[model samples]
Target: MEKHILYTTEAVNQDGLNGQSFIKTGGLTVTVSNPLNNKPGTNPEQLLGLSLSTCMNATLQAIEREHGLAHTAEVRVTVTLIKEENFAFLVVARVRIPGVPLKTATKLVALAKKRCPVSKLLSGSSYYQVQVVEDY
Candidate 1:
């Protein structure tokens, strides 16, 4: 099988979680900080949550359009950092599609989980989960 790349972007972080991260193409930049600290910056957990939520919702929108339904799906992701023996993260993605039946919404979410790139990448991780919810 041949790989056909649709899009690609590079991000550079020089100071780990203490300073800043920026896109290589010079479009976006963000301050990186520890979530436990009072610093005014973004953390990895929040960034993971944003990535999953955005990717899942965007895939849901495309699926809804293909199914001839309104794009009313909403995705909320929660990422928790755990400190057991080492550092770990727990990710949960909840999706809700208004005006659609629970069963159908669940099916849509299942398809989205299978299709979304971020979801696919995290599917093998035991700490990752995706579920359909009537309310977030």
Candidate 2:
């Protein structure tokens, strides 16, 4: 079996309706922002939306370079949650590839869906491994 290294994130913040959620890693900063909840950070829903598109678009970008396809793609992912319905969250990923044939775009989208890391994670192909070590 091929082995893959995993990563982790440690998020720290305050409690209650107003607090900040910031992640610090490798000289990078990510803030979770939700004004309504008084949270100065991106909530889970927003994160999910970003993740899906990020993955899909990254894959498309890679394919574009590999295939020598000269076209910029506009990717938009919509995530909806209906409490009354049985399905909780539905993610619709749309890609607008200019100068690319419709049939070719469709095929690339399918391939990207299979290759994107976030897509794989959302599809349940990848999972998180959590380990807690006691420090006393």
Candidate 3:
């Protein structure tokens, strides 16, 4: 049997970069914009960062659980927007697993990279960096 999963998020941007509507699959809506614009709400790039970061962390957590390791992980995702012709963006994911051995943390991050769908998706379209910033 083949399995398929589908997810969706709806967004509306109006007044140029002024106010944008964001609707999650759960029906949660909010206004989003660039903080540089001094406008209300969060920015789109940041939202992408948040999504990918959390997804990566979740994957890592699952890995820890699978290995029966008691692990608490901290993950940070950052998106950088480049201003140039055609423009571009970059994503940096930083992970910290305190109380876990460095070798183990490295292994888990490497595994998460393979398991994380978000990283795979972004890797094809943009720059993605993964770093194990801390391990005990």
Of models 1 and 3, which has the larger lDDT? 1
Per-residue lDDT tens digits of candidate 2, residues 1-136?
A: 9978797777556643244555655443456554345646656566677877777788889988788987576677776655654635666677877777777777777777778877777665222211111210
Question: Count of backbone clashes for each model?
Answer: 0, 4, 0
Q: lDDT for each of the candidates?
A: 0.94, 0.65, 0.80
Model 3 agreement with the true structure over 24-80: per-residue lDDT tens digits: 454655667766777678776878888888899999999999989776988898888
Q: Which parts of model 3 are misplaced by more than 4 Å? A: 6-16, 24-26
lDDT of 1 at 132: 88
TM-score versus the correct structure, for each prediction: 0.97, 0.69, 0.83
Per-candidate Cα RMSD to the true structure, in Å, reads: 0.8, 11.1, 2.6
lDDT of 1 by residue, 94-133 (tens): 8999999999999999999999999999999999999888
Cα error, candidate 2, residue 87 (Å) = 8.7
- Report the number of the highest-lDDT candidate: 1
For candidate 1, the clash count comes to 0
Candidate 2 — worst ten consecutive residues by lDDT sum?
127-136
